[model samples]
Target: MRGLGDHLTIGERIAFYRKRRGYTQEVPAGLVGRSTDWLAKAESGRRRPPRVDMLAELARVLRVPLGDLLGQSVLLEDDNQLDDVPAVVMR
Candidate 1:
């Protein structure tokens, strides 16, 4: 069956998550300090994808993992593995 994740490009993925999170196009653009026109072009694939740093910011504004925007999400099949995750101290 066709699904939300099916046949999605990077741009479409951004749009999908933005909508799922109840954000208007302008909302994420504004939060990322970019113009709606720029965000529109990104969502429509009229321009090259944003640079990695900018994409990271966009992911942050959209409240999604950077990997999701970059299409690198990995699934942990075992929930118990969460206990194995180590906490990190950021300097």
Candidate 2:
């Protein structure tokens, strides 16, 4: 079985938490003073890593612990090595 911590790239993780908290891109974008398209780009991995402020706002909206967004978890049984990845981006 795939774990939630495994299958998620940074953008997908953001999108997952956003949806989980009932937030649409437009809504959080407005709250954070960003354009909806920019948020879309972030969520789709088309943009580079979001700025710190954006990440903070996203964390607030998603209600996730900040460490989760920062990818700080490491279960001994998990060998995925997903740690140290702050964000995912399309090149």
Candidate 3:
């Protein structure tokens, strides 16, 4: 199956995760200590966060790995758990 990280910009990925987590723009914006305008700008691709730590906080609030927010792959499946379904997400 395709992942959320595929064929998406970083801003698109953030909006996707934010919506999936049932967050209003204000929710994560507040949680990450930013204004709504900041998040809106980010989601709209009008701005990019200047710090990796800021990105990490957004990922935390949205319950996704930072790599996912960055539109990069995150492999969560364990090799020993071959019987379980894989939930790998990729850039």
Q: Give stretches of model 3 more than 4 Å off.
A: 74-91
**lDDT order of candidates, best first?**
3, 1, 2
- The backbone clash count of each candidate, in order, is 0, 0, 0
For candidate 1, write residues 1-91 as lDDT tens digits: 1245547666787888889899899999998888999988988989777776777788778877666776655344466221222222222
The better candidate by TM-score, 1 or 2, is: 1
How far is 23's C-alpha from truth in model 2 (Å)?
1.8
| Candidate that scores best on TM-score | 3
Q: List TM-scores for all candidates, in order.
A: 0.71, 0.69, 0.73
lDDT of 2 by residue, 1-91 (tens): 1256665556677787788778888887887788999889988978885765577677777776544665555233266433443443335
| Alpha-carbon lDDT, every model | 0.72, 0.67, 0.72
RMSD of each: 7.7, 6.5, 6.7
Which of candidates 2 and 3 reaches a greater lDDT? 3
Selected candidate, larger TM-score, 1 vs 3: 3
Q: Model 3 over residues 21-71: C-alpha lDDT tens digits?
A: 888999999998999999999888787642566877888899777667765
